[model samples]
Target: MSCQRGQYVTAAVVTAGAISGAYYAYRWYQENATKIPEQWTQVGTLKDIYAYPVKSCGPVIMNKAELSILGLKDGWLRDRFLMVVDEKNNFVTARAYPEMLLVHPSVKSSVLTLKHADMEPVHVNLAEVVTNQCAKTARVWGVEVPVFDCGHETSEWISRILDKSSNNFRLVYYASHGARTLRAGTSKIYRFTKNDTGALPDEVPFNLVNQASVDDLNTRLKETQVTPRNFRPNFVMKGGKAYDEDNWKFVKIGDNVFEIIKPCFRCILTTIDPETGVRNVNADPLETLKTYRQSTEPAARRSAGSSPRMGVQMSLRSAPGGLVKLDDPIYVA
Candidate 1:
């Protein structure tokens, strides 16, 4: 607490002070430099760069996106964005008609637009897109799912959009369980298309990364080579190596905090190229992850939080919470 900048300080005094400072530095390194076990990297953060508005549609780049309890941004344009519902039984889009890709869709305000090569912006009100005056529970991704209908006009409008010289084209409503706990079977049971299962809309998990992990992964792959987008992550970190967040029980970023309860299980979704909507069941980034990142496979045939988790998609606490900007520091309290 007292000034000792002058040569008046004795040689012994200076030596002692230097030793104390070195000791403190060593202690600081010990506290901050240690990496999480099975994770040889430091902590890192990943900012959501692009928001895919309509599921499997297009990516909407955001200046900022809110972090919610479920990782689903409250007012996010990508939150519960677009869904391809089966015209036959009120199901969502999937592999039934792979040509559904030919059907492009967009949304603005309370209206959603569905169009294809020859189709026009078929406007349907979000509030009245379909009407069944009833509820239906269907199996999706091997799980039971319940959804409600929009009403009459919306249904008629959707039918009109896909009905042009079309006999098997129709529209339905998809009730999304945004950012729920990781339930592989549940997700795989809810059907969107014939072979396609439902998604937990806002359900991507938060896989913590550290600086050391980034350095190591980069040492092997280099650059932002293996990207978080590959995992469709809702959060990311660049300051460390991959898989650096293995042992974290909880983490907070900016003003949002999330519980790191379990390892997120991986699925074939990561194999699908979000850009081209192409599917390659093997020889993917997952191959690299499998070499290092696959979590302990579950005991039973299926379980929640038992799959290979890559990121944490927290449940939305507030509708479109607030903005989680780029480079925001994530703190593990």
Candidate 2:
């Protein structure tokens, strides 16, 4: 009888231990399931906010800008909503005409103004452009996007500034009502959100650069030092380790949250001086970055080739209309 009792006691203890272990496991899961695996870490501060009214032209520096699926905006100004295109409706950038970078664009009330060193400031009535311009398509990065012709005067102004010999260039406005599709090859290469439709930009809507990264690169540069402006990022951040953004997947600024899509690959565009619109003779930054910053991932390497990674391309994860302001604390996860 004692032997049987001992067997029963052993079985009961075993059952009890199993029950305790299971209970603890369940409790642990319950606690952890509701918690985020990665906590947000304070990384940096947004030093400057820029909205490029015209692609590859100049930035309209803002104290604060409203986040949109299309990108950053403030009242009458929007980011990359306007572009200069060739006679063939192909997008023209500072890449072809480095002088385009010197063109400063600004908007106030209903008026869009373009100021260049060589020409008189030309003003376009935004209200009129919206109402009177006809819908058309323009090719950018091999994708055709719906746009509106900003009429003859603006076209002549742009042509005169960009190419005085031929009146072939035209100014076009993004027709927000129409959809801009991404190229299939590009979509396959990068994990892009549904809203990342190429929208006048080369790829994603938002680009962010670490100022410390630029400062770091300057140390390596022999003669030509580049700035965040040369990268043409919408957001510039400081107070972080150089190239800290490479590890970031998501970032929070104020009430806005943005998903980092991929590292922005550096191109010859980075070799151009933002202030002077002149391409570096030695290609200091792009060439230097190529030596150290090439992607190791197979897919990224296939897509980016030897292009060096610099700023990060992003898409807004939070609801549109959140304001991202200068001096805002940036948190990354």
Candidate 3:
């Protein structure tokens, strides 16, 4: 009986020690998870900054901009804060109507101006849209988002430019106070918190492209050369080896810090020319990327299928309101 008691006590002590060790290990990881490493590698330099005030439309290039949780911002211009929707409130993009890519959106003072080569420039009073327009819900990528209609005048303007016969389209601005719930499949892959959903962006708030990578891809093209604009990245970096961004978990530019969330999977959109609004006949770059850039992990392969990995999607890790500027050194940890 005495021998049995000794064995029982020894087993109990062993189990207790294991539990204590696990507790301390978890505590250590929790404390260190968010801490930036002391040593970081200088990966590249910020070459350009882009803010797409309207989704699938032209970008507003800036030398310096404030980083917000939603995305890059100036006084009245925020990234992907305005989107075009059909009469049914379904989101529209350049994918269906390639001419949408040619619409240039710019903001000055309290007005938003939209210019297209084929049509006259139209202006919308942004302040009036916010103060007077009624809030309504619009569907985008299977998510419902709160938005304000910019009235029939702007709607008619956009509709005439895209499709002259049908007055079935409308211009909508994001209601700044509301958030859209991410689709279950997207949330599974991105692991975004409630606060991470930003306006009408396709996914995350920030997208970064390495210029070296685009150059490398151009080398593989037989008849076509692609540029960073094809990828629609918010931040463009240079001076790094091609595809070095694949390994970066976190990056810092100026005083702004961003956590790399996932590899941006390329799609048919990359095949479209941002300048001409025409798709490549051969789909050379995307086809070329398929040969080499497919994700190796089985789970990632299942999630992304045949899409090739290009830039990295990111979220602001440091507090918002930090400024990122042209030529800022990009440090990766």
Candidate 4:
């Protein structure tokens, strides 16, 4: 009986040792085995509280903001909700045509307003504006899109505002705008005013950082005294540790969490501040991006899989235009 007991003890010890070794090895593999990135710890929180109607228009600031699971604000609409398309319904952005950078938009509760500082403000009634049911084909930002145009009134309004011959340009529905996390707006296409800031989105499909990247570019263009607003990020995350958002794949604002989809690409729009609608000499944010942040071969929508695309959208969220408390703990969930 004593000998049997000794054998049992030895066998149990060896088995336990093997199990322990295996566990340790498994942990090691999980830590360093795969190329897939692991969840990065949240060191800070960011609040996205506005939507830029035009691809590079002025911002429609929101008071309460939410984070989305996909990591983009709910306010982000894929195609610019408002645009000046040509005769064939072709679209435009600040990308190739830097002149378009001069146009700025301001959204109020009942109207969509445009500003050019030097030019008078043009307002479009939010109520009269119409939308389409199915997605149609259009092009903006070099990306061919299945875009739907807004109302005929919107086209007329734009024609007069631009003072062009007026062929067949109109507004497009921003798909992301309808993605609301609250019960505020009647539909996804409702107009926003300073008062409606409370209805923020989950996470806009795109995430923008004010200070770091843009500032970095500004430094490169020392002579160009451009404001970060020229870049028109959905929200500006400042006063936190530098680059706090670099690894932030997800963050929560109230009940909203955001998942970053793709990196926002820099365009000629960066050369102009949406606020002043003036040309900026900043280091052409696009020029710097070309060095890095290049796109993949099997690019998504408009990707030639060339030039760099940096801004990434998070999911949208609901908002009362609430304040995001500083140092708000962000979970990786």
For TM-score, the strongest prediction is 3
Which digits, one per residue and each the tens of the lDDT, describe model 4 over residues 1-333?
111111101323446534643454344334323222244454435544456566544565555443322122223221235555677766655554454556666655535677664556666653333221344555543434444456666566556545553534576543322222333322232222221211122223345564555555556553555555665665566444543454455555434344444445555666565544455554455566566546543534244244555444443323222234333444433
- lDDT per residue as tens, model 3, 66-174: 8766788886788999999997999999888888889999999758999998878999977667656667889889788878888888788889878894478999988
- Which candidate gets the maximum lDDT versus the true structure? 3
The TM-score between candidate 2 and the true structure equals 0.87
- Model 4 Cα shift for residue 316 (angstroms): 5.1
What local distance difference test score does each model get?
Answer: 0.44, 0.80, 0.82, 0.46
Error of 4 at 16 (Å): 63
Across 205-298, the per-residue lDDT of candidate 2 in tens digits comes to 8999999999999999998778899899999998999999989888888767887788999889889989998789998699999989999999
lDDT of 4 at 76: 28
TM-score of 1: 0.57
| TM-score to true structure, per model | 0.57, 0.87, 0.88, 0.57
Better of 1 and 3 by TM-score: 3
Model 2 weakest lDDT span, ten residues long? 1-10
Better of 3 and 4 by lDDT: 3
